[model samples]
Target: MTYKPATQDQLLAIRANAGIAELAQSERYAAAEPDLVEAIVEGVGQFAAGEWAPLNRIGDLEGAKLENGVVRLPDGFEAAYQAYVEQGWNAIAGSAEHGGQGLPFTLACNVLENLGTANMALNLLPMLSVGAIEALEAHGTDAQKETYLPDLVSGAWSGTMNLTEPQAGSDVGALRTTAHLIEEGEHAGKYRIKGQKIYITWGEHDLAANIIHLVLARLPDAPEGSRGISLFLVPKYHLKDDGTPGARNDVRCVSLEHKLGINASPTCVMSYGDNDECIGELVGAENRGLAAMFTMMNNARINVGSQGVQIAERATQAAVAYALDRVQSARAGAEDRSPVAISEHPDVRRMLLRMRSLTEAMRGLLYYTAGQVDRGDIGEPQAKARAEVLVPMLKAWATDTGIEVASLGIQVHGGMGFVEETGAAQHWRDSRIAPIYEGTNGIQAADLVTRKLGLEDGEALQNLFADIARAAADEPQLMALAGECAAIAKWMREEASLDDRLAGSVPYTAMCAVAVSAWCLMQQYDALDDSNDADRKHAKRVTMRYFLDHIVPEAIGLKASATAGAALLYELDSSVLAA
Candidate 1:
């Protein structure tokens, strides 16, 4: 029998057991005026199938092209983008006052997963725009918000975050971009930015009439290093008071990067001040660019994590479809002339099932994390604290799992996986960026160790362990898996004794992701079993058991290595590494 996604009613019942419903009804959710959870889920399923998924290969093969300093999107992207804008998807999590749908983070995540599953490259522009919106909402003046929010939310305009410079890849302090105050009275109070930004996604595109670039630069008199940096909003084209694009802004795309994936989304080398009059308005207080950018960066990090989930889900589905149809050697009791589907083979079945289970667990973790984000914004002080602490964990684990799951999908296809036409390879290539981007999984693990571990005088880490303990304590079925999760979390706290936390951090991040995902899956199992929806209940239990038995042990090994510390990687000489 063909396997279908558990129905919405069943998913909701499963979610309820995972504490999703209670979280939705919490004060924080109410305050956000977040859309009903059911609507969000329904919208996601429809959008994934109807709008996004069909574009994956089309966008990948016919990616955006750079011509005469302008970017041209793939065929059908404009129409698909139009459909997305019309649906008001750009503003799902935007503040209500800005003509947004005012949905919660959890709902927004649901949509993002679908978007990623459909076409990650196409959705990059909107993803960046929403992060910019959040940054502006958090820090921009009323005048700026009044001027930019409506167009941004309506998708009449798009946005990008410009943070990297030639000398400053990960180190913000090394940036040399300069933002001098314009001397002319007409442009007074506006800064003229001059520098180059590299590897900027959606930096220069014609998908929208105007592109709003939130750039970071240093004032002439500002202090050195990171303290000297400041953020600005530099649009692609100057807009009239009526909000229509007018004269071209000095910013222009120098060239587009030929990347390993996401070719459909233009990654450009943007020159900010070639004309010497690129007008930019200050974002927040001076010398606080990194801090202000963090708001956008963190939001983007989570969104990127969701993208990883999307790719994994799509790839897993595609692999399963192929497995059940592709004929290979016969299974036990089958005759030589009667070859069975690849899925009939035990090894192939194991890989495909692992891919499905991991993808599901990842989705659950992302939604659960988003629920916490909603709570942090509106829940009590303690709830907010808990949510804040979980952000890094969620971001790290989900993205890492995305890479693993996508890779497993490729493995299920055998030799055909490497062929681009199969579409399996695309997922693997695209997923590679997830762990490397969004602050890198290593950076995420370092954060977990240095900051999050010692939070609340070491009580925060213990609280997380306690929650897992409590979840496992009463449920004998989950006790072993939950204990493993607790053990890994404990090892993460003790990783400080090892040298060079960053070296072994990525694997640790992946391990943590697996453990945490298992914990969340167990919660889903509890939810489904408690609900009246029998199919969903059975499905959740089976999936949870699959994850706990097969995936949880992966974390146990990772914990062993993380406990071994970063010294091994550090010992490898740069000369030897290069050789």
Candidate 2:
């Protein structure tokens, strides 16, 4: 099946909904123009379909290989990556001060969506690099940024985040990795990092000239737990006197994980300072690694949400294509009719509609969230706060929905989806990890309920509800959904017990996602032009109505779950669970 990029109408609607034109007037995005943004997204879509889509199956089959301590990417990955770099795609959304094209993050999200749909595993390399760029740009010292930013932004060097250890996982405070000050060597004043990091995506690969690792470790006198952790910039190869790549660093990929999906992306168990020579420079301050890491983590969480949208788009497209091509049973109304395309079957149509609607909803939610980030960059304090509150929901719900949509795509294919040759199964496998990465969905829910709700003493969430209410006030179709969400938010706010709030967090988060998605879809509906493309505008309205009718009601059950309290949850003991 031929991969299709987001249509011009969809991109324009997203831009209008995201207020890209208004943002362009701001000092931060003065260089941004509507035409240029459209061109960029279109070019990205074309490039991805042409360069990366063809390699998706090959990447899955060949995977990443670890031979004698070196990591080699699947066939075509290296060449494709080089072409990507040469095209200056990596610099599109980077800061102009650091050799970037200075585009808004919304455009970046669009690019990522296209790339991820084309080839998720290959897309991960740049995804991690963007996170690292954000981290270093925010927290790295002047020297560190000068040394790394240009190459990283230029895609000559790639980056990775090293936070997970076998013993630590999400409990970053439990990390055993330690960094001690080096007082007597050429790298004096820097720290010598020693220990291991696991689940490092694109951790060790030959795709770039260098790999910069943003590592979280503990200092000697640092306090125990998360409060004591510190961030470090550890390069794969130490820099020479002239700032060129020199001798190898002490970091190495011990082994690669055999995973259920994303086989082309190397997930490595990285060993640092095995030879006692891994030198790392501190980023931000000592005992503040978690804070610095959040800079990257938050960025990654947003991108990860986009990944969900990406896979859903791909699966939906593939499923629709298969349904149109594969002949099956006759329509229910036709008695003596020959077997028609399964798309002619009502159940298959339902599945395809479910997949398409959810994917559209997710895209709306993600693009809106990305717009918030862009707004925040332009000195909007309220926008920044709203973004912080929405990030967790975006990450958790979008990913969960991605998995659900992919599963539906598989079901639409019936027996064919279960087999590897059809490729539907791969989308399911690839999507399975999104909920677990960048912090598990459970953690995201917990963060949304506990931490995000506390923003501005709860004013942030209140503003969010108010905006949804305002958006729905003129549209009768959305008012009920908006009211339900507001009521849930009110109940959550009044719930005093931490455990009670935590128990209901996941559902509450999901409810918020549905509400926001509905609001975004309405925005698209309002912005649609009947004169230019009447059919497309009508289709948008129909999709919005379908989403509200079929999917928005999910908020009701989710609300019930949110207010269900912690009693029933704890009623089952560990022994009972084990049994």
Name the best candidate (by lDDT): 2
Task: Name the regions of candidate 1 deviating beyond 4 angstroms.
Answer: 1-14, 17-20, 23-28, 31-35, 333-337, 474-500, 530-533, 570-573, 576-579
User: What would the TM-score be for candidate 2 when compared with the true structure?
Assistant: 0.98
lDDT against the true structure, per candidate, is 0.75, 0.88
lDDT string, candidate 2, 1-579, tens digits: 678887564485457557888888988788778788878888989999999999998888899999999988777888999999999899988988899999888878787888999999999999999988999999988888898999999999999999999987888899999999998868889999999999999999889999999999999888989999999999999999888889999999999999999999999999999998899999999998899888878778989998889899999999999999999877898886899999989999888988888888888888888888899988899999989988998999999999998999899899999999989999999999999999999999999888888799888888888888887776554666667666766677785478888898898888889888888888887777545888878877877887888888767567678888899889999899999
RMSD of 1: 3.0
lDDT of 1 by residue, 285-322 (tens): 99998889988776687788777677777788889898
| Candidate 2, residue 8: how far the Cα is off, in Å | 2.4
* Candidate 1 positional error at 287, Å: 0.1
Q: Relative to the unseen true structure, what is the C-alpha lDDT of residue 197 in candidate 2, on a scale of 0 to 100?
A: 96
State in Å the error of residue 237, model 1: 1.4
Each prediction's number of clashing residue pairs: 4, 0
Cα error of candidate 1 at position 505, Å: 3.1
